[model samples]
Every structure is written in C-alpha cells, then in structure tokens.
Target chain A: MNRKELIGQIREKKSFLCVGLDTDIQKIPAFLLNEEDPVFEFNKQIIDATREFAVAYKINTAFYESRGIEGWKSLIKTWEYLPKDCFSIADAKRGDIGNTSEMYAKAFFNIESSGMSFDSVTVAPYMGADSVKPFLKFPEKWAIILALTSNEGSKDFQYLSSDGNMLFESVLQKSGEWGSKENIMFVVGATRGEDFLTIRKHVPDHFLLVPGVGAQGGSLDEVCRYGMNKECGLLVNSSRAIIYASSGTDFAEAAAAGAQAVQQEMEKWVREL
Target chain B: MNRKELIGQIREKKSFLCVGLDTDIQKIPAFLLNEEDPVFEFNKQIIDATREFAVAYKINTAFYESRGIEGWKSLIKTWEYLPKDCFSIADAKRGDIGNTSEMYAKAFFNIESSGMSFDSVTVAPYMGADSVKPFLKFPEKWAIILALTSNEGSKDFQYLSSDGNMLFESVLQKSGEWGSKENIMFVVGATRGEDFLTIRKHVPDHFLLVPGVGAQGGSLDEVCRYGMNKECGLLVNSSRAIIYASSGTDFAEAAAAGAQAVQQEMEKWVREL
Candidate 1:
C-alpha cells in the first residue's frame, strides 16, 4: 500500500495497529492441532478477529519456516487469506547482494513467481543499498529497513557512533537516500520510545514500523507522543499479546477483545489528528 | 560438522572450496525443465559433479524461495541429496529477535522440525548477540555471521568507523563473545582481500566463510594469503562462476571442471597448512 492509502486506512480505522502473526504451532489452542493445517486455521481466525482493529498484518516468516514444506504451505495459505484492503507485510528480514536480492524480491513481491506478494517485506540494511533496492523496484510495494530494533541484540551494532550519528541513524540517513518516504519505511522499536525523536530528525515523513508495543513492553502512549508525524506515520505492531490472549476455545474472541482494547486506546491518539 | 571435522574435510579433500548452489530455475538448461522437478534435477547434476572437489555446498535459499512451494520442495530434496560427508550450509542470511531467531534455528538446524539440517546457516549480525545465539544452541551446528559482505553496498555502513573500529570490526568483536570458535564463524567477503587482515585480528581462530571469488572477481590467492590460518580457516565460495559454468547440455561437466580448477587452487593453499 502507498503512503496516502496507509494514512487513509489509519484514519478510517482510527488505529495504526499492525497485528503481527508470529504464530507458533506449539502455542496455539490444543484442539486446533486436530485440524489439517492448524497454523493456517489459527491465523485465519486471528486475522478475522483482529482485522476490524488493524490496518496492516505482519506475518513473521520464521514462525512458518520452522515446519519446512508444511510450514511453507501454511505461509502461502495465510498470505492468500490476508485481507487485500489491509496492508500485508512479510516480516522476513531478508537481504543479500543485488542479484540474490532480486530473487528475494521475487520471492515476496512477485505473486506470479512466489504465489504471495506482500505490500512490503522487512529488510535488514546490513548489506546496504543494493541489498534493499531490489524490493523498491516494485511499484507501490515497500521495504521496511531495520533501524533501531526492539530486541536486546539491537545494542550490539546499532548504537555504534560514527560521524556523530548512531549506526541506526546512519542506516536512516544513508538508506533514506536509496528510496523515498513513499516507497520505504523504517523499523524503529517502540521500546526505544524517546529515540523516535532522534529517528524523526532523520526521516520525518517516512512511516516507522514499531514492534514491541504489547508483549515486548513498549508503551503505546510514549510511541505516539514521540513518533507520530502529521500523517500518523507509525505502524505499532502487537503480536503475542493480541493473538495469544487466550488458548481456549474462544481464542478468536479473546484476540478480538485484546485488539479492540488496543484499538480503543489507539482511537484516542488518532482522534487528535 | 564440528571444527575438527571441517578441518579434517579440508585436509582430506585437499581443498577448502565451497560450491554455492545458487541455482535459478530460469538459468538452468531448458531440457531439465522437462523433468518432474527441474531445479532439483539441475542441482542433483551439479552436486554429483562438484562433490569430489568441494568440501562444502552452500545453498542460497533465495533462489529456491522465489518459486515458493515448488521451490521449497526442491530445497528439501536438494538438502536431502547433498553428500553427507560435505559440510552443508543453508545460506539463508536470517536473523530476528530471540524467539524468532529460535524458530529460524529450528528451521535450519532441527531436522525433526524443518526436515533440513544444515551444518551451518549464514546470519546477518545487524541485530546482535541474541539474534544469533539460538543457532549455536544445537550441538555441532554453526552460525556464520556476516561481518563484511562482497557487494558494492557493503561500503555503505560496514566501513563506518566507530570507536577506532569499523562497524564490521565491531560485529566481529562483539559477536565473537556470543559463541565459541567451535560454533561460531564469520563471513568475510573475498572481494575485500586486504580487509581479511583486519578481520583476522579480531577472531583469528574462528573459521571464515568467504564468498566472492570467480564470478564476483575476488582473488583466491589474496584471500588465502591474508585470511588463512593454521587450520586453513576459510571456506571460499564461488557461486555463479562454478554453478552456471555452462547453459547447454554440457553444464554438469562444465561445472565439474570449474569446481576442479578452484579445488586445484585451494589445494595449493591447504598444502601449506
């Protein structure tokens, strides 16, 4: 989805929530395991329950890849099942050299080639510009480059200071030149809420895909206070807290409740816009 | 394969050559397309021909993933077909948060879960220790972290100097503490021959997976001169140059000849050890 459409969706839904489907087979309700494709069934219900509150869905590819061919099958099915109106993200932190990266771009963005075309795919900027540019070749598709990640590991190399800018800041400044705000977004962890001010200084207009709001203990309010642009340029993701709210028979309903609660909270923030 | 076994293989084969099976469906011979599984068929031939000279086989996951389900099927089959004696690497430069990284570990290392157990998997170090540690959990498995890459884009952030060391240097220093030399390896691109000297200074004992010779214009002699250690700590990879040696019916023979030439060069390097 383009920047305008993404903002419009956030306005209409009154939420910039991106529900992350980091669905693990072991974590799902036991009864669902009796089904042929439990992972897909779980995702289908989660998508159905949470779509009302979310403007985007980010499918973490690692969750599906763990099952091998069966996992891949579930991933393709889940991608097919995602609502077209909602922006889709294949959270497959993929990047390589120019030619190899082209194959990755085809894997995620070319539906005819890979049977799934996400609106965007999360990319690691470690390999630099050529590693990311392939994804930008597709019109309206986006490349969400990892900036300041939420994980503890984010400190390892991301914070290294060079020329007075943190490594992630350098990532923002250099990668920002590779693509425009229209086609590129950055993944800035919500846990580092105040860092959003620093992030905004680099790419004020680009949307930031924030993960860590729910289970990872990132404050949504702080994220909004520091990160939100005039266009509400933020996609705060909540994965475990929303999807695994309950492992009971009413799991989908529980997820709906969890999403609705977050959405209601988000509604209050978007109201100022 | 453990450190000792890998070293033994290098000595036994008299070569430290890693044949990269970056098999693209479009690039394979047209006659192979008539087979039940063309990509797999093509890979089978390439493997059969190259195994004698190669101590390792690096499968670039992007090539398989681009075809989606069928591609994944080919990957599993090719993984199954790989010679058990040779070190297998799922060159799927994957990294994420802790839980997500665990899933990725299972995807590549745990055969029971993912149906493919590779000796090592390439990991991007942008996320840091936690993102890479899970891959080291499995006994005898390895996480080949990306330090300096081969592409033009590597110049962007990798060379960024911070605290008297480049970003890639910091990655080598910090990530070196995550796992022992036995379980840890770093990808020091062959294109940057002189940079290998700097890389050796950080983790002299750890093995380095070098990619960029031949097709990428890296000098094998220079890589060996600066990168090699007492154990001949380098698995130099050549992908397109060796795999796509010929596009006609003589492709397999051409690939075998190409691999042999590299192996002969590698033989000279290992003789010193």
Candidate 2:
C-alpha cells in the first residue's frame, strides 16, 4: 500500500488502528482446536469482525514459526485472507547481509517465492543500510526499522548517549538517509510517552508503527499527543487486548468490541487532528 | 553442543570449520532441480561430503525461507539430515519482545514445537538483553549476538562511541550479564581484521561465529590471530566458495574437495593452538 492510500484509509475509517495478530495457539479458545486450521480460523473470525475498525493487520511471524509446518500454512492462509483494502504487515523482524537480505526480501515481499506478500515487513536495523535497503527494493513495501523499542531491554543499548544523541536517534537520522517517508517507517514503542517527541524530531513525516499499547500498558492518547503528524502518521497496534479479549466462545464478538473501543478512542484523536 | 563437546569435536576433526548451507535454488546444479525437493537434496549431498572436516553446519534461513512453504519444509528436512555429532547452527537472525522471543526460541531450539532443534541461533541484538535471554533459557542452546558484523553497513551504528566504548562493546558487556560463555556467543565478522582484538577483550572465553571468509574476502589467519582463545573458540564460515565450487554434475565432489582444502588449512591452525 502507498502512503496516500494509507492516509486515505485512516481518514475514511477515522482509525489508525493496526490490530496485531500475534496469535498463540495455546492462548486461543480450546473449541477452535477442533477446526482444520485453528489459527487461521481464529484469525479469519477476528479479521472479519474487526476489519471495519482496523486500517491494517500485523501478523507476528513468531507464533506461526513456533508451530512448524502447520503453523506456517496458517500464516500463509491468514495472509491470503487479510482484507485487501486493509494494509497487511508481516511482523517478521528479519535482516541480514546484502545477498542474504535479498533472499529475506523475497521471503516477505515476493509472493511468487514465499507464497505470502506483506505490504510491509518489520526489519531490524543493527546490520544497517545494506540489510534494510533490500526491503525497500520492493515497490510500495515499507521497512519498519526498529527504533526505541518498548521492552525493558530497550534501556540496555537504545539509551546509550553518543555526541549528545541517544542510539535510537542515530538510527532515525541515519536510516532516514536510506529511504524516504514513503518507504521507511520506524517502530517507536507507545510506552515511551515523551520519547515520541524525540522520534518526531528525526522523522516528522514517516509513519511510526507503535506497539506496547494495550497488553504492554502504553497510553494511546499520549502516543497521539506527541507522535501524530499532519498525515496521522501512526499505526497503534494492540494484540492480546484485542484478539484475546475473552477466552470464551464469544471470542470473535469480544474481539470486535475490543477493537471498536480502541477505534472509538482513535476516532476522537483523528477528528482533533 | 556445549562448550566442552564443541571443543572436543574441533580437537577430533582438527578444524573449526563451519560449512554454511546458504543453498540458493537457482545457483545449485540444474540436475537437482528435477528432483522432488532439490534444495534438501542439494543440502544432503553437501552435508554428507563435508561432515568429516567440519565441526558445524550453519544453515542460512534466508535461503530456505525465500522458497516459502516448500523452503520451510526443506529447512526442517535439512535440520533433521544434519549429522548428529556436528553442531547445528540456524543462521536465522531472529529476536523480538520477551514473550515473542520465547516463540522464536521454540521455533529453532524446541524440537517438539518446531520439528527442528538447532544447537545455536544467530540473534540480532538490536532488541537487547530480554530479547536474547529467552534463547538462553534452553539447556545447552546458544544465542550468538550480532556484535561487530562483516557488512559494509556495520559502520552505521556499531562504531558509534558512547561513554568510553563503541556500541558493539556495550552490546558485549551488557549481554555478558545475561548469560555465561556456555550459552552466549558473539558474531564478530571475519572481515573486521584487528577489530577481533577489541572483541576478544570483551569476550575472551566465548565462542565467535565468524562469517564472510571466502566470498566476502575475509582472511582466516587474521581472525584466528586476534579472536582465537583457549578452547579454539571460533567457527569460521564460508558459504558460496565451498558450496558453489563447481556448478557441474560433480558439484558434490567439488564441494568435498573445497571443504577438504579449508580443513587442511584449519588443521595447521588447530595444531599450532
């Protein structure tokens, strides 16, 4: 999906919500286990229920990868099932050397080779420019580089100050030179309230994929207050809080309600902007 | 796959060679493509030919993942086919949030969950300690953190000076607190000649998975002189050079000859140690 199309989706839906499908088979309702592909069935229901409120769907690859071949099949099926009007993200944080990275790009962005194509694939930036550049080679696909993650471990290296700037600041500034706001996005955790101001200083126009909202206890209002640009450049993601809202058979309805609540909150923010 | 067992294999083989199975379907001999599972077939031949001289087989996940479901099937099959005595390394540079990282750990380390159990996995450290700690949770499994990489992009943020140490130095010191040398290793690129001395200072006892030997023009002697430790703590990887030595029908024979040459060179280093 292109930037204009993404912005249009946000404007039309009055929601910048990107529901995360970090689907764990163990966490889903036990009744679904009897289905042919429980994970995909669960995702199909969630997507069907929440597509109206969500502008995008982010599939976390770890859950599928852990389950082996069957899980991988579910992942591909889920990708295929995702509403075409809504943007799709393969939340596979993958990166490597140039030649190797080309293969990774093919895995996520080339449907012919990988049997799945995501509009964007989250990329780790430690390998720097070459590792990330491969992802940008795909037309209309984005490379959401890791910057200022919300995890407790973010303090370990991201906060390290160099020349009066933090490590993530350098990631933002340097990575900006590699791709435009059209192609490059940064994953700035919603938990980092005031840090959104800092992230904007480097990437004012680029969309920021904000995790750590519901289950991780990040305030969506705070993220919007500091991070939102003229284009509503933000994709606030909520996984467990939305998908696993209730463990009972009313799971799909409950997920829709949870997403609706978040979308309602997002609508106020989108209107104010 | 523990430190002692790895050293034992190195001593017995008289080499610390790690054969990188970065099998590209397009690059493999055309004859194998006619087979049902060409990638797996090719990897089987290469592993059988090189098992005698190599102590480890680093399966580059990118090459397999690019092929999608069939590629993933090939990955599991390759993992199963790996000689039991030789250490298996999944060169899948994966890391995420703590809970998500646990799934990644299960994907590569837990045989019951993913149908593939690797002795170690190459982890990207951009997500920091918690992301890495999950991998170390498995008994005898290793998280080889990306410290100083061999790519041209390594200069991007790795060399940024913070306080008194470079970013990679901080990665080494901080990650050391997470796991012991038995469970934690660092990926110091072979191309970074004298930088190995700097790496050794931070991690003297820990093993280093050194990539970029042949195709990328890294000197083995320079790496050993600086990075080698008491346990012969180095796994030198060469992919394209050994695997693609000859593209003809005698590809397997040529690969064996290529691995033999590297092992002979490595034998001299082992003898000196």
Candidate 3:
C-alpha cells in the first residue's frame, strides 16, 4: 500500500491501529489445538474480529517459524487470509548483503517466489544501505527500518552518541537518504513517547510503525500526542494485549472488544485530523 | 559444537574453512532441475564433495526462503544432510525482542520445534542483549553476532565513531559481556583485513566467523595473521567462489577442487600453530 492509500484507510477507519499477529501455538485457546492448523485457525478468527477496527496487520514471522514446515505452512495460509484492503506487514526483521538481500526481498515482496508478499517487511539497519535497498526495488512496497526499538536492549547500541546524534538518529538520518517517505518508514517504540519528538526532527513525513503499546505499558494517548502526523503517520501495533485477551471460547469476542476499545480511543485522535 | 570440539575439528581437519551453501535454484546446473528436489540435490553433491576439507557448513537461509515452502523443505533437508561431525550454522541473521528472539532460538536451536538444530545461528545486534541472549540459553549452542559486515554499505553506520570506539568496536565491547567465549562469537568480515587487529583487541578469546573471502575478495593469509589466536579462532567462509565453482556437469568436482585449495591454504595457517 502506498502512503496516500494508507492515509485514506486510516481516515475512513478513524484508526491507525495495526493488529500484530504474534500468535504462539502454546498461548492459543486449548480447544483450537484439536484443529488441523490451530495457529492459522486462531489467526483467521483474530483477523476477522479485529478487521473492523484495524487498517493493517503485522505478522511476526518468528511466531510461525518456530513450528518448522508446519509453521511455515501456517504463515503462508495466514498471509493468504489477510484482508486485502488492509496493509500487510511481514514483521520478519531480515537484512543481509546486496545479493542475499535480493533473495530476502523475493522471499517477502514477490509473492510468486515466496508465497507471500507483504506491503512491507521490517528490516534491521545494522548491515546498512545495501541490506535495505533490495526491498525498495518493488513499487509501493515499504521497508520499516528499526530506529528506537521498545525493548530494554534498545539501549545497547542504539543510543551510542556519534557526531552529536545517537546511533538511531544516525539510522534515521542516513536511511532517509536511501528511500523517500513514500517507500520508507521507521519503527519507533511507543514506550518512549517523547522520543517521537526527537524522531520527527529527522524524518517528519515518513510513517512510524509504533510497537510497545498495551501489553508493553505504552500509552496510546502519549503516542498520539507526540507521534501522530496530519496523515495519521503512526501504525500503533498491539499484539498480546488484544489477541490474548481471552484464551477460552470467547477469545475472538474478547479480542474484538479489546480492539474496539483501542479503535474508539484512536478515533478521538484521528478525528482532530 | 562447543569451543573445545570446534577447535579440535579445526585441528583434526587441519582446516578452519567454512563452506557456505548459499545455493540459489537459478544458479544450479539445469540437469539437477529434473530431480525431485533440485536445490537439495545440488546441495547434496556440493556437500559430498566439500565435506572432507570443510570443518563447518554455513547455510544462508535467504536462498532457501526465496522459494517458499519448497525452499523451506530444502533447508530442513540440507540441515538433516549436514555431517554430524562438522559444525552447522544456520546463517539466518535474525534478531528481535526478547520473546520474539526466544521463538527464533527455538526455530534454529530446538530441533523438536523447528525441524532443524544448528550448532550456531548468526544474529543481527541492532536490538542489543535481550535480542541475542535467548540463543545462548541452549547448552553447546552459539550466537555469532554481526559486528562488522563485508559490504560497501558497511561504512554507513558500522564505522560511526562513538566516544573512543567505532560502532562495530562498541558492539564487540558491549556484547562481549552478554555471553562468554564459549557461547558467543562475532562475525568480523575478512574483506577488511586490518580491522581484525582491532577486533582481536576486544574479543581476543572469542571465535570470529569470517565471511568475505574468495567471491568477496578477502585474503586468507591476512585474516589468519591478524585474527588467529592460540585456538586458531576463525571460521573463514567462502560462498559463491566454492559452491558455484562450475555451472556444468563437472560442478561437484570443481567445488571439491575449490574447497581443497582453500583447505590447503588453511592447513598452512594451522601448521604454524
């Protein structure tokens, strides 16, 4: 999905919510285990329940990869099941050298080759420009580079100061030159709400995929206040807090309730735009 | 493989050569395409030929992942076919948050879960300690962290000077505390031969998995001179140069000859010890 279409969806839905399907087999409702593909079954219901409120879906690849071939099968099926109108993100933090990265691009952005083509795939910028440029070769596809991540380990190397700019700030500045706002986005954790102020300074127009909300104790209000752009340039992701709201037969309904509550809150913020 | 066993293999084989099975479907011989599983068939031949000289086999996951389900099938088969005596590495440079990294660890380290158990897995260090620690949870497994890579883009963020050390130097310094020399390793590219002098300073005891030789124009002599230690702490990798040595029917023999040449050079380095 391109920037304009994404903004349109957010405006129409009145929410920038991107539901993260970090579905673990062990965490799903036990009854679902009786099904042939419980992981896919769980994702199908979660997508159906949250589709009304979300404008996008982010599938964390690690959750699916843990099951080997069976997990990979579920991942392909889940990708096929995602709502077409909603932007899709393969949250596979993948990057390598130029040639190898081309293979990764084929894996995620070329559905004919990899059986799944996400609108964007999360990329680690540690390997630098060539590692990321391959994903941008596809038209309208996005490369969401990791900036200031929400995890505690984000402090390890991301904050190292160089030439007065922190490592992530350098990532934001240097990577901005590699792709425009149309093809590039940054992953800015919502936990550090004020970091958005610093983030906006480098790439004001590019969308930021915000994680660390809900289960991670990040406030949606603070994210909206500091991160939201006129185009609603913030994809606030909520994974566990919404998907695992209930592990019983009522799981789908509970997920819908959780999503609706966040959507309603998001509606208030987008309404200002 | 543990530290002692890996060094023993290097000494036993009289080589520290790591043959990178970056097997691309398009690059394999056309006759192999007639087989039930061409990619795996090609890899099987390459491994059979190179097994004698190589102490390690590094499978670049991107090549297999590009083909989707069939590709993943090939990856598992390739992993299963790997010689039990040689150190196996799933060169999947994956890293994420703590829980997500745990899932990745299970994907590569836990055979019961992911259908493939590699001795080590390459991890991108952009997310820091928590993202890498999970891989170390498994006894006798290793996390080969990306410190300095071997591409033109490596200059983008890796060389950024922070305080008294460069970004890659800081990565080595900080990450050294995350795991011991036993469970931890760092990828120091062979292209920048002199950089090994600096890398050895921070990680004198930990093993360095060196890529960028042959196909990438790195020198084996220079890598050994500056990077080797008492245990000959280096696993130098060559992918395209050795694997794709020939495109005709003589491909396997050519690969054997190519691997033997590198092993001979490596033997000289180990002989000095």
* DockQ: the better of candidates 1 and 3: 1
Regarding DockQ, does 2 or 3 come out ahead? 3
Error of 1 at B112 (Å): 1.0
**Chain A (candidate 2) TM-score to true chain A:** 0.99
Candidate with better lDDT, 1 vs 3: 3
What Cα-based lDDT does every candidate model obtain? 0.94, 0.93, 0.94
How well does each candidate superpose onto the true structure, as a TM-score? 0.99, 0.99, 0.99
Off by over 4 Å in 3: none
Tens-digit per-residue lDDT, B183-204, candidate 1: 9998988887789889999989
lDDT at residue B105 of model 1 (Cα atoms) = 98
Question: For residue A270, what is the lDDT in candidate 1?
Answer: 94
lDDT of 3: 0.94
The TM-score each candidate achieves on chain A is 0.99, 0.99, 0.99
Q: Chain B TM-score in candidate 2, rounded to 2 decimals?
A: 0.99
- What digit string (tens of lDDT, one per residue) describes model 2 on residues B1-273? 898999999999999999999999999999999999999999999999999989999999999989899999999999999998998999999999999999999999998999999999999998888899999999999999999999999999999999999999999999878999999988888887899889888889999999989998899889888989878999999899999999999998999999999999889889877
Residue B101 lDDT, candidate 1, scale 0-100: 97
- Clash number for candidate 1: 0
